[model samples]
Target: MGIKIGCCGFPVSRKKYYGEFNVVELQNTFYDLPSIDWAENLRSEAPGDFEFTIKAWQVITHPASSPTWKKMRRKPRGDTSNYGFLKPSNENLEALRETVRVAEALKSKIIVLQTPPSLPYSRESVEWVREFFSKASDIAQGFILGWEPRGEWSKARELYDIIEEFGIVHIVDPFRATPHLGKGGVVYFRLHGIGGSEVNYRYKYTDDDLKRLHEIVSKYSVDREVYVLFNNVYMFDDAARFKRLINS
Candidate 1:
């Protein structure tokens, strides 16, 4: 068991980032799905042992009203509410297929599907997720499906049961909540800062915070691979510091 520390995005140049860390959770894929050629080029440029985990395209989970849509090359047209939210629509399914293609091109081991806070905990939501994953599982084969459910879905036991049923890894912010879906051999932790009602991206971690994180990693990394990804203001520095702490 070992710990892999990285940031949500490349905070430094690719060469410098690869020199420091062996893993990165690509954020670009979440906002916009890149061409397979572009993804392959990135994969070829990196070291063979380097690990790439991509965030699934927004169209797989977010509705068109999401501000993130503005960043996408093709914005949804009228009645965009049904475009996403895992509604099993053709557009969303096509978007997910594209996302899977990109991940395959990059040789990504994990594809993270982060649902928006608006997708609350409910029987309908759970059923939607189950249906979506049932279809998505066929296309996203050969990769671990990681899910980061926001809002009330984070606390719902039914959600965890569904996750376990599909063998999905729970992506979580350890400071916010312990993951309920504990089926996989990988423990993915996304650190988005602490001491706020929501994610505090402005916060910077201290040595004590790093030490606490180290303790958590040590406990979990004894058998499983623990991925600690920083998603805060000082992500690069914080991740580096955490790497050094864990190594020490």
Candidate 2:
């Protein structure tokens, strides 16, 4: 069993980050696609044993109205609704294709699809995602696709069924919800800090929290490769602490 601990994005210089952890989930790719040259350069610089997981471009899951779209180099034209929301539109399909190219350039084995909290649960929405993934399956071969559905969709059984059907890994914040979908192989945990009704990005994990997290990972690590990525403000420190706690 193996547990790879890291942060959602780099919190320190590349050299320091590589020295501290064995994995990283690239957050830049979620906001906008980077050039293949940039991805190649990063891959070339990283240690051979280091692993990179990338967030799929927002254009595949978020609509134009999403604030994250403001950072994108290109904006959607007419009928912006068709551009994202996993509608199986041509525009979204092309965006996913571009994401695959970037992932390949970085030699990333995991591609995370994080939907906005606004995308609520519905039978129609479930069907749309099913169709979207089905259409893109060819491009997704040899990659571990992880879907982090937020809002009401995060609570739906239909969403879980779709994940199982598509062979998608369920990405979750263990502090929020334990993943009930997907078969065993790899478990991806994104910690966003437990707080009121939603994630508290400002909250830092305590030693007690780290211990509990270690217990959770140990349970899963019996037969799966677990990736515990901290997404809070203190992600770098928290991940380092958890790594020490788990290894001890």
Candidate 3:
């Protein structure tokens, strides 16, 4: 199967961006759980054929009251982890459940459980996550749960064991998650570039990076649905570039 290419709706105008790509990640939901009608409006903006996968609210994975913000360069870096969306409280879980409910209504395919870089792969975190999945999956219907690890944890195999056991997908960027490419199950590859992590803005994949990604996509085309997203948001034009790259 040919791998499907899309992007996270970061720096793009939905009206124009959705027309180019077949999928766009609803990342804003990671901060605040919006109403169903609002979510549907986003879906409506995209073509009828396009599919959307939303990131779960951050309260369960990234709680508030962190000191990293002052050290960061941007505001609302849209990190999701900096907010109190992942607190280990009833209210937080309830909010997560409601988000899942909405995604299910919209027939969304994946719910990203993106964890912060600081969240170590400890036994406690694993157990908590397992329990959260157990509860969330029940309410999520058939929506797949996926994750993107921020830091060095990307190289750890133990994290894969947990994710695999839970039957969750791993979201990876070539620069950060390249070392952890041996993972199985569903994989979401976000191709930024050979070394575009520094710019972190609108960027494009280098020719070499494109060749390597094309090879990887060909390698994994046998069975699994490979969801490849673009992250370089050049003044809200990243999705258009991704479309041109794939359709070229």
Best by lDDT: 2
lDDT by residue (116-199, candidate 3, tens digit) is 766666666666656666666566657787777665456565667656566667777755554233334456876554454423
Model 3 lDDT-worst window of ten: 68-77
Tens-digit lDDT track of model 1 for 134-242: 8877777878889988887777778777777888898899888887646779989999999886589999999998888787778888889889999999999999988
Error of 1 at 179 (Å): 1.3
Which pairs in model 1 have colliding backbones?
Answer: none
Instruction: Tell me how many residue pairs clash in candidate 2.
Output: 0
Q: TM-score, each model? A: 0.95, 0.96, 0.78
Candidate number of the best TM-score: 2
Instruction: Please say which candidate is ahead in lDDT: 1 or 2.
Output: 2
- C-alpha lDDT (0 to 100) for residue 248 of candidate 2: 78
For residue 36, what is the lDDT in candidate 3? Answer: 85
Per-residue lDDT for 10-70 in model 2, tens only? 9999899999999999999988689899999999999999999999988889887888888
lDDT of 1 at 189: 90
Candidate 1 to truth, TM? 0.95
